[model samples]
Target: MLSPDKVSAHADEDWENAGAGDTIDVERLVAVVRRQWRIVAVCMGIFAILGLVYILTAVPKYTASTSVLIDRGNSQIANQMQASVAAALPIEDDASVLSEVELFKSDSIGLAVVDKLKLLDIPEFTSPARSPISMLRSLLNFRTWFASDDVAADDIDTLRHNAADKIVADMDVDRIGRSYALSISYTSTSPELASKIATSIAEAYLVDKLNSKYDATRRASEWLQERIDELKQKALDSDLAVQKFRTAHGLLSTGGQYQLLSDQQLSELTTQLIGAQADTARARAKYERVKSIIDNKRTDAIVTDVLDNSISNDLRKKYLEASKLEAEISARLGPDHVQAVRLRSEMAEYQRLMFEELNRIAESYQSELQVAQTREKSLQDSVTQASSVTAAAGETQVQLRELERTADTYRNLYQTFLARFQEATQQQSFPITDARIITRAQVPTAPSAPKKPLILALAMALGAAFGGAIGAFREYRDRFFRTGEQVRDVLSLEYIGHVPAIDAKEAGSGNKDPESVRGLQNGNGITNYVVNHPLSAFAETMRSAKIAVDMENTSTRCKVIGVISCLPGEGKSTIAVNLAQLLAMQGSRTLLIDADLRNPGATRAIGRHAEQGILEVLLEGRPLKDVLLLDNKTKLAFLPAVVKRRVPHSSDLLSSSIMVNMLDELKAHFDYIVLDLPPLGPVVDARAISPMLDASLAVIEWGRTSRRVVRTTFAVQPEVMQKCIGVVLNKVDTEKLKLYRSYGSGEYYYNRYSAYYHEA
Candidate 1:
């Protein structure tokens, strides 16, 4: 049994064991989970209820959609072009049709829509608002939502313009994919209105397209008419210029051959004059030179001397031949040999031939000069005749060129006027267009705002997160260690035994019911296998541990042991009583002592009074038989604490020489003497008395008295701990025991000990 002081000491130790922060207690966690299941239920239920409410109240929407196949309308356009154009175009790729399609999307087409629909009143096409809506919004607090309220229009045109701009927003035009087609869709509060607008826009666009084609055709016709007129005038003017020049110059009949004949005659005459002049000059020079020679009147005489000297000429030849021969000999043979000398002699003969030829040519020049005089007179006469013919041809060419230029001018003017007349005749045949409606737009039946499901789901998720936060905060603040497993795992201790809970009625094993603490086989004993099946497992486990501990030393077989606990009512005294009787039943003599001097809950545990027990023997020095209480059923003996001193000084008496002798005597008489000591915490009694024992077991209430008290029970002095065998955790809940699965046969443990109550 644990003294009050010991229980207090153990509690302090257990608290200190829990570090910076205590860890989660599984027993407490189980209790919390049991208590807070309703909280979790409420949170989940709230989320579900909110989801249902959102589903019930939210507005439902339907999407309205339609599709159209775009039509490029190019084939029809090409056919129209082929029918309308007269001249063959040199174009490889014509852009007129594509340009027309672009024109349909232009502001010109938009204006065409305005014209057709008479939408000049719409704001988009009308005059600027001039601080109208903006000024109103700034003035009124409600302006953002009611911005258009105070806008003032100056005239019907402004009103129509604003309306037109607003209506334009009700229509859409999209170029569909890569094709030349366009898709247009309109949305409106009224289905019919949207359909009307879409269909109207399409009709208006087609009208604009037709107008584009018509306008292009009209412009083409007008331009071609003007060009044809200009070309006709140019042709007429060219003809008139040719005719007028002929009239002015009077040689309009000169054909193309006349100019060629005159040019040829002029070229021949010019050549003849040049030759005549050259001949005359040559004759005059010859006559003058001959006369000078005949008269010897020329006095610059170097030429005359050379002409008259024959000897000098012969010397020149001989020297020339000698030089030539020397060159020949050097090239062909030796320079100073006999063949070279003979060749020099032959060259001397030919040297005279030069003077002979010169004399002959001078004689011939005199005869030729007389013949040239006669020819010069004849050539001069021919040149004069040719000059007269060339003059006549020049006059004729000038007249014919003037006539041709006049005729060209007249012809160009005439042609220009005639072509203009011809082009005007072609304009009335061009084409135009008639516009009609195609597809209509439809109104949307659903709003484009507020998708309910997505929004509500987000809210529910947020609510659940908040709810879980509330649950987690409450779990962090609790403070006790609630399980034996916590002590085992957290403190790193061995588990020895689990004592079944002892009820208050069947608690006393010392005097009233000794049989209850007897053998493991009977139906009605304290630790019986039949009557108290749950306790039997605890007893069996204790027996096994006892054998293991005792086997380490043979002297342990007859050693006296003690049972201790963390607090009062933790089944320590009961465990001591049952254990001793069990050993006694096994034919080993056993004694059970209740040694708590301060508070003896152990006496109450055995249904005995704590009067004149240990205190009477120690203080008055009486015989041990005066206080010993013996039960015969299981052959167990008991001693109760007689002193109920608020401050008991029993440490000296228990650890004294007399107590030591008494313990030795008991050890000799019994195989196991069980002492139920005062708790080690409140006083020094248990520590002082520890050296008199072989081993001790600490008892702890399973789900009560926390880890603090249990550890303090074990953390006594080394003298006390030397006798500390292990521990016993008492009063486990059977149904909840299944949570610890390592106790594979825990149900049997619970069932076996639980039968004791039924049997009683």
Candidate 2:
């Protein structure tokens, strides 16, 4: 029976392979780009050549510009002309200048330029211009040159319209700030034609302006002349009516104004009535004073004028003397004496005479006052009658004044129309415009298009971008492990080491050696590189892989390491042979078994006959040491297998109870046993004997093996994968390892230590 201790320990060392679960691996992607950078460089070079060809063959084009300055100098004409003429012209505002810009690009202006310069004959305006691409097309196809030329008369108009459109499209008019100036630029194949068209457009605009102003003034003159004649006739008829009305009313002017006859009589009577009223008042006052004195018997109290008469004054004096005499007589005689009586009689006679004189004076004053009052009343009645007659005549005077005002109004209107007619006639003879050309157009000297530097710069940038994108896409689609990290990340297995490719020189081949079927051939028949090149880095890396396998085993008994690969040519047997040699060189007893009955690579390398290998011991039930070959230099033993005699398949012999018992018996003699199994990718031999092994290691060809094939190896035969301990990335290219060093840790380590090993 197989040793239970070794069998159970090997079972425990088995681990899941990468394909046991899915995961994303990016390190392998970066390795693909680094490995295929040459392809990307080639693609970019091709694009650069194409760009150069296009730029060199492109046709050269020219453009020309001309400027015209619009100065509103004609605005000064408004100030020089009459006010009415100035009011009729358009004023220059911001809107007017912008309107002129639109007019400069107008179809009318474009058509005028086309007609003046006969631009329809130019091929660029009438049809599409010939470019480099179009010229190439015409050369390739003869049908393009024989295109139809027949068209209707309407097509000629259409052609002219199209030419006008092209002229307008190629021309640019720009206003200079807020000023009335323009920069007119035109693009064409000929510089002279562009400048000539620009100049003609400006001249056309000036002529159109002058004609517009002249027509407006002529229309105004004709309308005014008709209106003036009508106004003159109306004025004359109004003056004749005013004179006729004045004669019919029989009015006259006393001052500078006309007056009625009744109004004159009323004026004279008013003056006489005022004088008679004053005389009547004075007479009545004198009569009242005198009459009052006579009625009261106060003859002495009468006014001086009433008593100024001599007879009244003497009577008053005589009465005073008689009173004195009568008093003296009465004192001498008795109170009834005849002398006193006779004196009193004389005084009475004098008093009666004075009273009569005062009465006469009062009567004269009363009669004169009554006569003055009657005359004043009669004059007042006459004045009132004359004033009523004058009021009636005032109505006719108002009508006469209205007729005179109408005549004056008609005369003033006739004079104003006559003045306007004269001004309109003057405007017709000398018309003015609101805009004038300050500067004429001139030919330009340079083209303004097809910037070559910018085009080439963009072309080179695009080419590089396209090449990079293609490289990235190739990287994404690659399905292989190119770095040592892919062993761990993509395959989901532990990484043992990176083993550089061992060439014939490094393997130390000699003339006396036997040739091998497939391996690094060296003298002495496929010499173990680890043992021959002892101080080399490749030998050192094999030693490291031996240590890692040894660490995983950790058993005092025989440690069985099964070496396998996903594909047949991935160098698994070489790694196993070298690893066993390294372990034996360390003074440990090592056994290298060639268990691949189908393809015995190690059996052939050791120059041992295949019939005397493990199949003899297992099938014939022979002794354990009967088929073993020992090497003296490394102290390693090898049991090589021969495929000359075949059974049903390799798995039948590998999985048999005899094979297990054979491995168990050898465990007591060897410290480690390395099994070189057939590739797991193409056969089931590796999985069949997995349970009998301590641990398994995978060997991959760097940058050459497919990741999908390796994954399928573990996925289909999971039992073999469970016994796998780790992986070894073999046959690495050191220069490429340095380039893709950043892709994985194993590549970086290999690049750093590659110099330690010298190549012949």
Candidate 3:
């Protein structure tokens, strides 16, 4: 039984505060003891024997560990930015340590270590003294995996990988519960060897990291130097290209820069002057046309065309007027006359004026053209000055370009040189990494396995568990009982009494060779409750319960307590007789009634003569007093159930109130009565006989009555199922009780029973 206090204490010890879990898996050592006791026993036994074996014949290994602190001296190192310090130390980042870890696991590092130790060429370990288990392990080793092939590149790679893998495998690095420190440990049959291996691994890691940094920096310096040289050459070539371009172009000193600028200015002025001269000529022509338009209201088309053509517009106008006068004279005076002479003179004068005017205009036009040519000459001079200035400007531009090319070349070369120098100097310094050893493996004096105390304790507990398992299995699987409680619990009936399941030697009152009713038990008779303690509670309880039941109903009659079962051969007949005898011994007028009409058992078991009985009296309509059979020795009366092949509807006969009335009549004569009925499961005879009984009881064979079949048997009779008060479990083995007490059985209170139950 699990008590609240014990369970709570256990739960608290386990710190089980989780709200009741989805499923309670309380494997309280108790339940385990009750359930898997065998498994626990076996496991404990194995461990114990293993301990003993370890103590006796097993080799004891002593561990010797020495500690080391991988103090990556973080605080001791100087920071680069703090120039106030004497020396600026390189700060090592976490990445550096991780890198070292990876590199330490590299094949190059591992192979170097292996070569130094000469482990690579060590032939396969083929020792004759190897254990079978060890031999099996070696058989699956790498050498065997590739033993048949020639060494190849892939093989070499695998070898290197495995070598590195072995280093990690052999060395146990513990930073498990620690920080920034590695405690490396190695175990070997030789303590010194383990220490050496651990030390070597650590030293190898630091050295490898340092070498890698130095190599990387050295390579960078070499690359930078090469780049500097290449850049210098490129700068020189670019400078030469610019110089050649200048020489071919005839560009002199930068004085020509101004000359080219001056030429550009002159070209601009000349273009402007030419435009102005052309505009002046166009304006003069337009002015003459406007004057002509002013002088004459209408101007002829031919006059307009010839206005600026080496002739003045005024001359053309006078000539036109004279021509008009001559036409008038010719029209008025006929051929010759004095007036014609005067007009000719005037015409001559006009012609002369017109010629003079034409000459003047031609002169003026020529002058203007001459002036434009002069101005163009002046612009050419200005262009010449501008060309000089442009030359100076071009030369200055060339010099500026040359200077820029030189500066670019120098800067590029200087940058490459600086990079190379920095790399070389930094490489020369070879700054030590910031990482250092923190915690190292500690040497232990004892091994952690094969504890002896734990072994012995486990062994004792194992034995008890083994015994309990055997007992529990037997308790669940076995069938039958030989005690009163065993009978009452299964049948749910008040136990009349227990008549122990006896061996053939002490057997009495049962079938096989029970030849007589008088003094049936053999010599030195059976040591049964019947003979040993007649006044025991086992018998008294039966009498008391029967009395209580009868008194409650207040019916004093020969009502029968039917002793029935689901099937045959369950000691029911024997119980019926014993019960009647027990009642008789208690001075109750008891009658043992046998109602198994089809097959009579009482006539043989009791060895009583059954020449006249209940069957004969009932069917023949005879008086039942003549049918009463008395046990010759005990004061118990008996009613025999006759064996007859021709026994009519015996089930109906048993149920008829005629039978109830018959018992009612006999109740006046008898104090107690019992009926041994046929097995009620297969027949309805018991149900038919229910009215004839005041009370009833049934017996169950303990473990053999499976849950399924028990229900099957219980369903056989309605009255038997409904009226059954208690069950009787039979044939329990007592040996299991002792083991149970040691294993799963707890301390019980004896005071509860000590007052009432006296040991006999």
Q: Could you say which candidate leads in lDDT?
A: 2
How badly does each model clash, as a count of residue pairs? 74, 3, 60
**Candidate 3 lDDT over residue span 1-760, tens digit each:** 1235534654563453244344555643354356455655666677577657757775544333333333445323422422122232343566543544455456666666555554445332112236898788888787777676677778766665665556555555444233445455655544554565566666666676567656866786777777777777777777676566656555445544422335446667878777866866765674465455435533333433345554556655666776677778878986466776777777677666655554454456556666766776676677677767776667666675775567587767777576656646554474565456544545555663345676567665766566666656755564444344333334333443322243444343332224643332322222223423455444443455466446434654454677776666666665566667767776779887788887666555653445667777677767876767664455677777656556768888887777877888878888777888887766677778876667666655533445445556775566665655334333323333222222221212223333554324
lDDT of 2 by residue, 1-760 (tens): 1135544543443333244335554654576566777766676677667667676776444554444555445545653565454444353688877888888777778777888888888787877667798778768888657857886677788887888888788788888777777777776667777778777777666666667667877787788777777877888899889777867877787887766788778888998899999899889888888878777877458576645798888888898899888998899895579988999899889888878988888888889899998999999999989988878777787887788888888899889878777776766666666666666766767654445676666666676678778877766675667665556555666666677776665465532223322122224423477766777766776766676666766764678889889888788877888888888888989888988888877766663433476877877777766667666567788887756666676798899888888888888789999999999877889889999888888888887888887887777877777767677788877677676665235556664666777543
What is the per-residue lDDT of model 1 for residues 342-447, given as tens digits with 9 covering 90 to 100? 7666555444554443445445565666666666666666656666765766665676666656556556655654454344343234333332333334556665
lDDT of 3: 0.57
Where is model 1 more than 4 Å wrong at Cα?
Answer: 1-494, 501-535, 545-553, 567-569, 703-716, 742-760
* TM-score, cand. 1: 0.42
Give all candidates' CA lDDT scores: 0.57, 0.73, 0.57
RMSD of 2: 17.8
- The TM-score values for the models, in the order shown, are 0.42, 0.53, 0.52
